[model samples]
Every structure is written in C-alpha cells, then in structure tokens.
Target: MNKLMILTGEPLTRSILANFFDGISDFCVEGSFEDVPGLLSAVQNSQVDVLFADAEYAMQGNFLPLINPYGAKRPLIVLLARDGQAAAKSYEMQNVIDYVIKPSTPERLFLSLQKIRMQLSLINSYEAVGAPHSPRRDYVFIKVNKKMVKLSLDEILYVESVKDYIKIVTEKKSFLVYNTLTNFTASLPEGRFARIHRSYTVSVDKIDAIEGNTVEIMTTRLPFSRKYIAENQLKVFK
Candidate 1:
C-alpha cells in the first residue's frame, strides 16, 4: 500500500482528511500534521508515496528544497488551496501533481485518489517492461481524408465508437475513420490503451479521474462497463 500524509494548518481539516483517507484501500495514512516541522520529520523518517498539503503550509514551509525530483523517494503532492492565487503559486513546485480547492468533499477526494492510483499503476507498468535498448513506438499512421496521416500516440486522448465508424480524439482535433473500435485499438501500443467500455477505448495516461462507471478525460466524462473494472481490478489497482 502507498503511504500517505496529510498536512493542514486547520485542526478540523486535518481530522477530516485523515478520517476520509482511513477508508481508502490503496493508501495508508502514516502521518497527519498541522505544522511543517512535524510533517517534514515524518516524511524524512518514513517512506511516503503521496502527500496532501494545504496551500498555506506549502507556501510558507519552503518544502521544495527537501524533495529531490530525480530521486525515487520523491512523494507526489496533492495541494489543497483556499484560493486560485495560492493554488497557482503552489503549482510551481515540481512534485505537485494535483490541486483541490478547499471545502473538499468525500466524492472529490475519492476521485482524486482514483486518478492518482491509475497514474501510479501506469508508472509501475512502464518500469516493469522498460529496457535500455527497447525501440520507442511513439506514433502510428492511419488513413484520413484518403491520405495516411501520422498520429502520435501521446496526442490521442481516447477512442469512441460510433456505429460503423470510430472517432479518435486528441487535445486539439479529432479524426473519424471507417473502422471498428477493436481494430483501431489493436493498432495502438499494448498496455497504453484500455477497453473501458464496448464503445470506448481510453488512453490510460490521459485519464483525469474515475468515479463509479464514469472516467473523466479532460472535460469529458465517458462511461465504462463493469466488466473492464472487474477484470482489471488487480492488474490496474494492485
């Protein structure tokens, strides 16, 4: 299980976050502190995979120097901010992966943790299969407008099935092709894409958050079937 820590100046906020994280299956709340010194000490002594910190402490604590970005021991930070300015400022730190505005709800926290879990799982998968000499497979070509167009795998956000056609969505544009979802997905690299639903295949790294049957990618929420959830539970979340 991933070790998690909560650092908030408010007593109520610290208690609430600690209690909320208590029920999470993937993480163990190793420490909850209201001060910078105690939190820093705990992090130095123990192995923490994730840290949740309030913007107030994050800004005042000068925490960046203590963390090494290149080290394997670095903890992923989830910032909790009361305002946009502080949140934006906190984002300058290299380890801050996500930020949640104050008055956090159980649902919001769960969604954030779910997304983090997916990311950590993806990282582990890549590390397991990574090799020094492996050739990079970064892009693929597909026929679009009667011409073969190069599509970078990183550019693809998700794939949607529309009857006899499939739509490939990216950050900027989308492409419609005369192909089945399975056929199109097979062309992509393995482990990078997942068949979330019968009509949807999502880029694992592109997923923003997951709540119930819906997976959020950018601003869009795509429904996923329980079949994928059940079968990939161990493989994805383990």
Candidate 2:
C-alpha cells in the first residue's frame, strides 16, 4: 500500500482529508498535521509515498524544498491551495503530482488519490524500463492523407480514439487516421505502449500527467471514455 500524509492548518480540513482516505484500497493515511514542525524530517524518516498539504501553510513553514531534499524515494505532493494562482507557484517544485483548490470536497480528495496511485505506478514502470534515450524499436511508416509518413516510434506520445477515428499525437504534431484504437495498439511494438485507459494507448515515456480518466502528454490532455473504467486491466497500476 502507498503511505499518504496530509499537512494543512485547518482542523476540519485535516479531518475531512483523513476520513476521505479510509475507503481507498491502495492507500493508507499515516498521519495528518496542522503544523509543519518536523514535516520534512517525518517524510524522509517514514516511507511516505504521497503527501497532501495546503500551499499557504507549506510556504509559511518554509517548506520550499519539501520536494525531497533528503532524496529518499522522493515522495509525491498534492498541494491544496486557496486558488489557481497559489497553485501556479508549485510548478517550480519537483515531485508535485497535482493540486486541489481549497474547500474541496471529500470526493475530490478521493479522486486525486486515485489519480496519484495510477501516476506513481506509471513512474515505477518508467524507472524499471530504463531511461528514455535507451534503445527502442525502429520507427514505423504509416499512410496519412494518401501520403506515406515516416514516424519515429519514440516521437509518438500517445494515440487517442475519438468516435470512429484514431488520433496519433507526437511531440510536434497530431495526425488523424481512420483506425481503431485496438488496431493501433496492436501494431505497436510489444510492451512499448500501455493502454492507460480504453481509448488511450500512451507511450509510457511521454506521459506528462495522469488525472482521473484524463492522461496528459505534452500540452495536450486527452480524456478516455470513463464507461470502460471497469474493464481497465492496467498491470502497472496493479
């Protein structure tokens, strides 16, 4: 199980977050605090996988390097901020998974944890697979607009199925092809792409974020049909 921690100043906020984590099957709340005393020390000492904290409180406590200064597996952070502006400042911090606006609901917290669990699993898989520059299968050619296009496999970020069409997204551009997501995933090299969701076959190396059923690659965030959530069989998250 992934160990979780919450650092917020409001007593009610702490209670709400801690209580919300009770039903998660993959996460366990180790503690909740209203202050930042020994916060960094606690995270490094304990085997914490994820931390949820208020942005204002964290800044007040001088927790600037809270992104794993001790470098012990680098626990993920989910900042709870007063607004979007406060959340923007977190872009400078590494290991931050996501952020939530204050007065967020219990359901919101639950959803964020679910997304975090998936992300952490994917990160582990990436490490196991080695660095992005490591050797990979040769590029494949595909026909688009009645023209043959030579595409590097490493450049392909993810493929999305929209209605009857499949969209192949790369770092530079996106291509629309009349193909099924199933067919595209099958044509790829074995274990090269992971079906994060039914409609999205993501190049594991290109994943920027995983939030709910939406997977972000580069600046594009694509939502997979949530109807297939029950059918999801992602081994990485298992």
Candidate 3:
C-alpha cells in the first residue's frame, strides 16, 4: 500500500481527500495536517510515497523547500490551486515530479496516484530483472556564488564556453559556472545532447532551424565546427 500525506489548510478539502481514498485497498492516508511545520517534520520522519499540498498554504508562508534541494530527488505530487500561478512557478523551479490544479475531482486524483504507482512498479521490476540503472542526465548540482542549485536537464537549451567558464542557457535564465565546456559536455547524456562546436553543446530538440554551418536555437545562431558539421548534416538529411 502507498502511504499518502496531505497538507492542506481547508478542513473540507482534507475530509474530501480522506473519503476519496477510503475505499482504495492499496492506499493508506498516513497523515493529514493543517500545520506546515508539523507536516515537514512528519514527511522527513515517515516513509511517505506521495504528498498532496495546498498552494494557498505557501501564500500564507508555508513552503515545501525540500522538493528541489541541492541534489535531492523530487517527490510524487504537488497539488496546487489553479489560481495559484506564483506557487506553481515556485514548484516548477524546484522540479517537482507532478503538479495538479485544484479543485480536482476524485477521478483525476486517482489517475495521478495510479501513474505514480505504475512508475514505481516499473522501476522495481527493472531492479528485479538486474537492469542497470544509468544515472539521470538531468540530475546535476551547480554551485553559484556560494549557493547550490539543481537544474533539470530539460530546462537547458545550450551550453557555451567562455574562457575558463561555461555559460548554461535555459529557457527562463542563464548562469555561468566555473567549468570548461568539455567538463560540462561529459555530464550530458549521449545522443540527445551533442557538441557541435568547440564552444557550443546544444540540445537537439532545441534546434529551431539549421542554416549552412549554423544551427538556430531561438534567436541565437550557434555555429557547428568542422568535426560535427558532417554528423549534423547526416542528421538533417535523415
């Protein structure tokens, strides 16, 4: 049975969640709380499989900071209100597993829960079958001016060499890290990400258009070096 933890300020919402899962034999409501501090403590101590937290709770100064800690893994669910775009943005920056907008029906909630269970089951099956667990390409921790940050792989658009440093460009922002382009290239997964230039490594999916030796990514024109031009040409041909 999967243990679920609910952290919502509304009493009616809490009751509804409990009742919704009451008949599910494989799900157990381990804890439900209106207190954010108390809920955080409980989550840290308990073997929680999923968390359903209200977005309004964060507006009132109750925040879930652990979901995207340094190099920590993301939690299962983060339930937010449809009107709470600010809270949703915060959760997205942290790279939470999934976020659902309320007032969600029991059917929607059930489907989300089922998806989590299916994913977990698949992971377990892979382990049992002796399938090697390759390290996640997106799971990289970066230190910036004494603060550590975790960046999602999908968020990265491209990386460019700037002398001794590498500039990481994302959809929303960019950051300069004290590392060479080669070092950063090694961290990316093969095939999906490729070094097209001496200074540039771009996500293949982020390519807007390819013109001659330059690949267009959004507004930027990234040049492909002689070594990678042939390979990328073959890709374009296919």
Judging by TM-score against the true structure, name the best candidate: 1
Clashing pairs in 1: none
lDDT of 1 by residue, 89-168 (tens): 65644356678878888888888888678757855665567545446667765556544466889999999998766889
Error of 3 at 174 (Å): 7.1
Supply the TM-score for candidate 2: 0.50
lDDT of 1: 0.75
Candidate number with the higher TM-score (1 or 2)? 1
Model 3 superposed RMSD (Cα)? 12.3
Question: Which structure is stronger by lDDT: 2 or 3?
Answer: 2
At residue 221, candidate 1 shows an lDDT of 100
Query: How would you encode candidate 2's per-residue C-alpha lDDT over 1-238 as one tens digit per residue?
Result: 8888888888877787877888777779988887787566576568778888888765443463443433223467788887978976643344566788888897787788776878788657756774575566456545465333667889998888887567888878898864457665766776567776667888866766768777677787867556644544352244
Q: What local distance difference test score does each model get? A: 0.75, 0.69, 0.68
Q: Clashes in candidate 1: how many?
A: 0
Give me the candidate number with maximum lDDT. 1
